[model samples]
Target: MKASPTRVHHAPARALLAATLLSLSAGCTGASPDAEARPQASCAYVIEYDSRTYLGREETDVPVGESLGSATRPACDDTPGDGDDGEGRALMTAFAVKGVDPAVAIAVAEDPGAYRLVVADTVTELPPELRKVTDGS
Candidate 1:
C-alpha cells in the first residue's frame, strides 16, 4: 500500500490571519499609543509680587488670604494671599495654558518668574494684572 500524504492544518493559519487582521484594524483607529501619556494643559494659578511669581496647581491651594512668600522652601511657597503686607500675596492671577508640557508646567510652578517665559506663548487668556506678571511689570 502507498503511504498517505499528511494533510496540512488550515485552522491555525486561519486563526493567525484573523488575529493579525484584528490587530491591524485596531491600530487603524487613529488613536496613538501614547495619547494617554501625553501631557494636558490645565488651570494653573500664579501669584505675583515684588517681581516674583508663585504657581498654584489648584485654586484652593493658593487662597486669597494666605502668603506664599513666608515659606522658606519652594515646595511650601504657594499660599496665594492678598494684602499690602508686601509678601508674595500681592497679586493673584488665574489662567490656563494649552499644549504645555507637564515638565515645563512644573518648571513654571517651581519658579514662575524664571520659567514663565518658557510657556509665554502657550498662555490661553490672562487678566490685565497677569499681563504685568508675564511681562515682568
Candidate 2:
C-alpha cells in the first residue's frame, strides 16, 4: 500500500524559534550588571554651557572640583520628575520594557537650554576620579 502525501510536523522548527528568543533575552539581561538601579534619565539630554547651547548630555559636564550641586545644565521637561515621578516612571516602563508604544514621549521642553535649573531633592557631588581634572568646573 502507498501512503498519502502530507506535511510533516513543524514542532522542531517552532521549538528552535522559541529557544532562540529565550537565549537572546537572557543575553540582554546579563549584558549590564548595573542596568537595574540606574536612572532612566535621557542620555540625549540638552546642554547649555556659558551661553553656548549644545545637544545631548555630556559625561564631562558635571564638575568634580570646587563645588557640588545639581542642575549642571538646565533640564526643561514637562514631566519635571526624572523617571522618579508617576508619569515619567509609567511612560518608561510601558513603552521600553514592554516593547509597546503605550505612551508617547511628547516634546516636553521647548527651547530646552533657555530655562534655569534649581537643584532640589538630591545633592549631586562630583565624581572622585575627576577631582583633579578641571574642565572649567
Candidate 3:
C-alpha cells in the first residue's frame, strides 16, 4: 500500500504546532524575568492596636526612619468593651517596616515603641531574630 503524500506533510505540521504550544505554555508557568529586575516601592506603615508586633505597609511616601506621625491606630474590635472610641485598652502600637536600609531598620526597631522588621513583600509576620531585637529581649 502506498502512503498518501498529504499524510506525510501533515505529520510534520502537527509536530511543529505541538512544539510551539509547549514552548508557549512553559513560558507562562514561572515568574517573569523582569519581575525580579524591578525594584518594589517602599511605603509607610502603622501597626494595628491589636497586633503590635508587625508593621502593616501604608500607601505613603514617608521616608524611612521618620515617624508615621498622626496616623490613626487600627480599631481594637476583638477586645472586650474596647468600643469604637479606642480608649481604656492597653493599645499595642508597632511599625513593621521593610525595603529599607539595615541601619534605618535598626533605628526604627530601637525606638521605645513597638516595631518589627518583616521580610519584603511578605508582611505576614516578623522574623524571630527581629522580634527579639524589637522586644528588647
**Which candidate number maximizes TM-score?**
2
Ranking by lDDT: 3, 1, 2
Error of 1 at 114 (Å): 31
Report the alpha-carbon TM-score of model 3 versus the true structure.
0.22
Per-residue alpha-carbon lDDT of candidate 2 for residues 1-137, written as tens digits (9 for 90 to 100): 65556857789999999999999898868347766655444433533322333342222222211111121335344434345432222111000111111121101122322221211122244233322232323
Full-model lDDT, candidate 2: 0.32
List the candidates ranked by TM-score, beginning with the highest: 2, 3, 1
User: Cα miss at 136, model 3 (Å)?
Assistant: 11
Over the stretch 1-137, how does candidate 3's per-residue lDDT look in tens digits? 99886765678889999999999998865477675344333333433322233343322322235544322333443334323333322333224343443322322332354444432333345455445444532
For residues 40-109, write the lDDT of model 1, one tens digit per residue. 4332444443344434432222112222232121222322232222223332222233333222222223
What TM-score fits each model? 0.20, 0.29, 0.22
Ten-residue stretch with the least lDDT total in model 1 = 59-68
Against the reference, the lDDT scores of all candidates come to 0.37, 0.32, 0.41
lDDT of 3 at 67: 45
